[model samples]
Target: MKHSGSLLIVDDNPDILIAARLLLKQHYQSVKTTDNPFDIAGIINEQRKLEQPIDVILLDMNFTQDSISGKEGFYWLKKIIEQDANIVVLLMTAYGDIQLAVDAIKAGASDFIAKPWQNEQLLGAVTAAFSHAKDKQQVGKLTRQKQGLNQALNTPNFEFLGQSNAMQQVFSTIEKAAQTDANILITGESGTGKELTAHAIHQASMRHSQTFMSLDMGAVAQNLFESELFGHKKGAFTDAKADHIGKFELAQGGSLFLDELGNLPLEHQAKLLAALQNRQITPVGSSKAVDIDIRLICATNDNLDQAVSEGRFRQDLLYRINTVEIRLPALRERSDGIPLLANYYLKHFAQKYKRSLTISDDDMSALCQYAWPGNVRELAHAIERAVILTEGDKLDISSVVGNSASVSTDEKTQSTEVLNNVAQYDTFDLDILEQRTVRAALKHHQGNVSHAAKALGLTRGAMYRRLEKYGL
Candidate 1:
């Protein structure tokens, strides 16, 4: 397998690239070279998408014409790992730069070589890496044997549903990280389907056939954090009538999704970090260290960076879990996807409740226009409520957004009265008055043009021109 593996050598030096390519050509099935380190991510992603990923990357430690430091190598190594940890990278450096290449190992490079090396030394390192790759693939297969394999595939609610560009990047990240045993940290505002995304990742992963266990850190009591995560022996405590397996043991060889990760107790952060670092857990009242195998996925609405600054979180723990970070786009950022999500929820709940329902175009537009402060969760609840309450087959969003986005029926009547006063002004002085009125409305709204436009009975674009014309 090592002999048949594909190899990618990235270096700014073409002569060295040619020599390395020629040397490895006899053993490796394919040898590709690139002078640009920036293009490696795109190349690797494209290769993985085509199911022809490179097995190993021989990377140079320096790139700048006048530079000697291996900073360039570390940058590319991180980029490569962020894309896919499955690709084994061996950093290449001259004898004087050997220390820098060694530093790359801490940055995720599998191995490093001092250049002007023997042919046998490089071959041996590459051979060992392919063997390691084979072992890694076997671990994935072993994890896939865990219980509840089909449950994930059958659950439609766990599906990743989005066609927006943001979601495309998310899906791509999932594809790259899922196959590897990398710890993934998913970040987003609440109700953006963080758990759903975690489930989707598990389903797409090599561990899909295994059990996907999840626990809400915010819901778990501070006292129960240890017992819940690391199991409890019988009679370990007053409530421990029977031995209980923890999430760690239950999800062994699979994935454990820790939702609300930021809510974990400060007292227990160090314990959790130690267990993760050592890949071992000690049960309550048990002296034996239990070997654990779990791919970790954690999600949080709270900012951990802020938490670390406040000394509430362990920075080391953050580094351990965030091997790859996937940030989900909020519904407001991907407003175009609202109709799609709305329709999806409509059909799902409609079938569940045995109801006939459809959303009108005007209603859809209103739903999209309304700022979803609560993200997709609010939109979903609104749809479900509208479907259940409406007497007609079509959904009436009037009741849904009356207090927020849509103009109330009573307000419409009052607006009609305000329009009547417009003609009372002198026609020649209307322009002067219009500018003054626009400026006053904008001032009242604190220069929020959209609110000002709504207050002045003008569209946002119309308000823009009036502001520009008057320079207000």
Candidate 2:
């Protein structure tokens, strides 16, 4: 799979830098490295020219044997954050100055790792930081899109564009909720514009002038959940060479929108509840708590009530984060909004790619009829693909909608064969069937052993050997 972001590792120790680079190179296509923190800004400028933009920074607090206080790294962290608040910075902290890491977070570090860190922990931190950075970037992109749409319409300002009763009620609720400090919970299926709803509430609220930060809970790993949400101190572990800050700290005096909140592990939910109740959070390895002044806005696709009934989510956490709840209807549910959203995306993409395209009535009808399982995201991607593949100004729905018949036929045939085989073997042992299933999945994913193993509930090595056994 292609990674969506790049990372930059800065450390004075050549060995540490090399190790970090080696570890991240497999996951990220672009992993830049530098031993001197002073060269960071220049390197960032150079890397921006590359096809893929750098998304995260890992900085070591202490530079060399002589500079013990990590003041240089601390200054660089401030400068880098000032230059680009979007980049996620993970501080490398040493064992003795963990307090310094907490201070560094207050100064602007995204998260931190301790010295002598486990490989899994380091990887987890990087992944979490990069994921958070990507979410922030998407929020910024959406804000710009809304602004551009307003400019195109010559409107006084951008507001949610819908006249339906459902949307009118949503607007009214948002306006009323914006005046209070209560945590608001927004729920809907994917691509129902939950993030947009969050942004609208933020813009309409008393904290409009303050920074707005959003995070996707579904993207981060289970192990690093604590460090990513609460942050960690320097030397808190082996990889901690500097101090770091958590999301709660960064969202101080602002609104923290936790998107896809239902995806968070049950273990992390309790901690989050405590933070919401106390209005403060302590770094993962630190004992002291930092005060935070911000409103919480959480969104999720899954039903938290169902999750709690199933014991997969904590009811207490849900109660804490959802003082006010709003549910956005899916595109199909709001059929009247389909043409509006389609026109919005159509014009947006046309201008973005410098084309004069118009959506015919026939094309609009097809878009409305099609089941958008992936919601607005799928719709946007479909429009972009259609625009790129199209030779003329008008979009042809035949080419843009659904897979080719030949490809669909092949998939149907394969699925039927798999089902038939399982049915024929009435006495089949489930364990053996599972092993065979793993091998087949590996072959289907083009030998992506890890993904295949995950899908089949088997270890990667076990899946690899099964493939060999089946001569796949």
Candidate 3:
């Protein structure tokens, strides 16, 4: 197999350099030989200039004639490490001993090799050294990437809080699922805290101390999907000026949250599936495939099953990502949960804005009654907005009730008139009430489904179903 690693063999004896080069050249992508030890620094610098640093170095212990103390090898070893501490160095000498090997290793040499080594032994040693060097390089690269992404990794401090039966079941599932390395798929409506749930799982998992990298598939351009998820080499494309570590590598030994997975293009789903199935990824413009150890957690607001049936999604990919599926209920479906979330965000935003604020019992009741189409995220935003706008100590229901938004007095009067007109029939039948309410809302909103849905405390999907049911 062709290797992407580079090897450098340095020996004072021309014959040794020639022989080692000839043998290692077949296995390594780049192999350099020099009979002069002084050329080591120059050669290494040149490789760095080309962005292909040496992976392993075979150094002779006695570079000068009649010198056998191996101090020369130790000197160069220190220099190599000084240049790049992660580079693997192997010491070679004609006069070899167990003590020399011990001393060489203690001085940071990867291994000790005796002169006139067998080809198989030399190949084995170099291969092992190259692997070790690659590992170190990967770790260093990930550390740097983590430093760069530290600012973007601002995870929220709140847990997924809900007391309704649906939320209680979700909490139970999260606790159980976090115990294993199984891939988790969080399905929910938009603004339902899918990303937050992913964070909760990562925090609850054994890999809590490690990274929790999140990528919003919906926000990423389709053309950049592979590069964004699997990473890319420096100069991989017109804009790839530097090597970029993908989310998979950054989330090594942790959780990788792929938000909006259903938005992934069908053509790109195969690439993701291949990586997950193989447990490895080949960066764009690079032939080497890197093995990754990450617990995968994906979230989506779209109905993937319907998409799959419509041929917009792949069934196999769906199966691969949904080993444990946790669907978050819509805000309206979470019975008595809105008040809890609203109060939580109220206190949170109140402190954030440095204001003392409280929600009245009546206003809180109105908040509990309205259907939060935007879910917890919307509720948080609404509370924050109220906290910022309300000048009084107590929150005003004028802005917090009926869709959790500020509606003009005229609009409120018109909507109440519509509801009152619909209730004038005096029929206590729920179906009749629902049909009349849907019609009235649609009329009041000028046939705008979104506005009508929000005013009626219903999701767009629920609104559409009602429209279809009542033939409105």
Candidate maximizing lDDT: 3
What are the Cα lDDT values of the candidates? 0.77, 0.73, 0.82
Collision pairs in model 1: none
Candidate 1, 1-472: lDDT as tens digits: 4277678899999888998988888888878889999879777655554445677899988899877788888888888776565678898877445556557777888888887778999889888877766675556444533432433334545246888899889999999999899999999987788878898889889988887888778657788888888977644677874445778887888899888888787778889999999999988856678999999999988789999999988899999999999999888788888889999989987887889889777667667666665577667777776778777787766656653224654553444345334546686577788888888988899989878765554434446657777788
Instruction: Give the TM-score of each candidate.
Output: 0.54, 0.55, 0.62
TM match of model 2 to true structure: 0.55
* 1-472: candidate 3 lDDT, tens digit per residue: 8799788998989889889988888888899988887898888767755668778999999988899999999999999888677789999999999999999999999999998899999999998999899899889887869774683478775667899999999989999999899999999887787878998899899999888888878557777888888888755688975568887887778889888787688789999999999999988877788999999999887899999999999999999999999999988788488778888888888888899988776566567655555677657766776788788898755654543334554555554454335434555575887788789988998999988876654445556657888898
Number of the candidate with higher lDDT, 1 or 3: 3
Candidates by lDDT, descending order: 3, 1, 2
Give the per-residue lDDT of model 2 (tens digit) for 218-326: 6566777777678776446666543456677766787888877877777788888888888889886676788989889999888999999999999898888889999
Model 2, position 324, has a per-residue lDDT of 98
